[model samples]
Target: MIDLVCNVSNAVKAVDPKAKVYINIGGAVNLLYNDRLLGCIDGVLREELRSHPGPSGPEPQDPWETPAVLDTLAYSHSHGKTVLVGSRDRLKGARSLCVRAWSHGFIPVPQPAWTLGCSTPPRQFGAVAPQWLKATSKSIIRRPYTSIQYLSLFDIL
Candidate 1:
């Protein structure tokens, strides 16, 4: 896994030294603790932080807030890796998203904004509340969160 991450990261960097490489390990978030893997990637995309159980009914257990995940998040921050949370469930309200982000210390990706093919800012569109400021670092959160962008692999591959 480390080799793959390093190869892809190096490939992207070779074309554009400023490129940012973010990996989506899906539910394998524990891999964030690996120093070698963390060293090669710029950030991580945590997909489907599903709040609802499913289409059928409520789940018997919810594992999103488990201590292990929380610990991994802290470790990622200490390594200077951005954690981006993504969810496709539009049923979730903006306030709920903000509360989750505030509680977990992650930047919630505005799925609606991107899904609708528009460029509405998260604050203006209500994806993020003005009062809920994002803190990239666990120790320092007074400053606003800044989005990092890099050239896509498609641009140079």
Candidate 2:
């Protein structure tokens, strides 16, 4: 994960060396709520969306974290930075984050609803059948499943 963060930070630094990039280093949601860290971040890339269920099947963290994440989001937006929340569930926390981000002049980018593994193919709408359409469509359609699997595979690392 340090490598991943470094990669992203390095890429951003390469493009705009003055840009300050902050990475959250806990489980997905924990990273979402740390205001002190968020306060320093010029932009955020929230990579995972699901709340991890504890031994009892409820979230392991305090429920208050949700609001804290919102607070961090609001702060990021007020700073006029970009906040990209990547998640499998569009309705989970994405809607509120986007609404708040846009209200504060932050650019909000969301992952598509079919961003997680689902058996059904996504509906595609286009004016014409472009070259490599079939390959591109298949790749796009398979992304969620592939991504989920890829993330899971990293757990062993």
Which candidate should be chosen as best, given TM-score against the real structure? 1
CA lDDT of each candidate?
0.58, 0.44
lDDT of 2 by residue, 75-154 (tens): 66566545544443354655654554345544333345344221222223112222221232211122354321221213
**Positional deviation of residue 26's Cα in model 1 after best superposition, in angstroms:** 0.6
Candidate 1 lDDT over 20-125, as tens digits, reads 6787766677789888899888777664565434677533226645456657766897688877665555535544654575566666664453453322235554
Give per-candidate clash totals: 0, 0
Every model: Cα RMSD to truth: 8.6, 9.2
Model 2 per-residue lDDT at 88: 35
In candidate 1, what residue range of length 10 has the lowest lDDT sum? 132-141
Show the colliding residue pairs in model 1. Answer: none
TM-score of each: 0.65, 0.38
Name the 10 consecutive residues with the lowest summed lDDT in model 2: 118-127
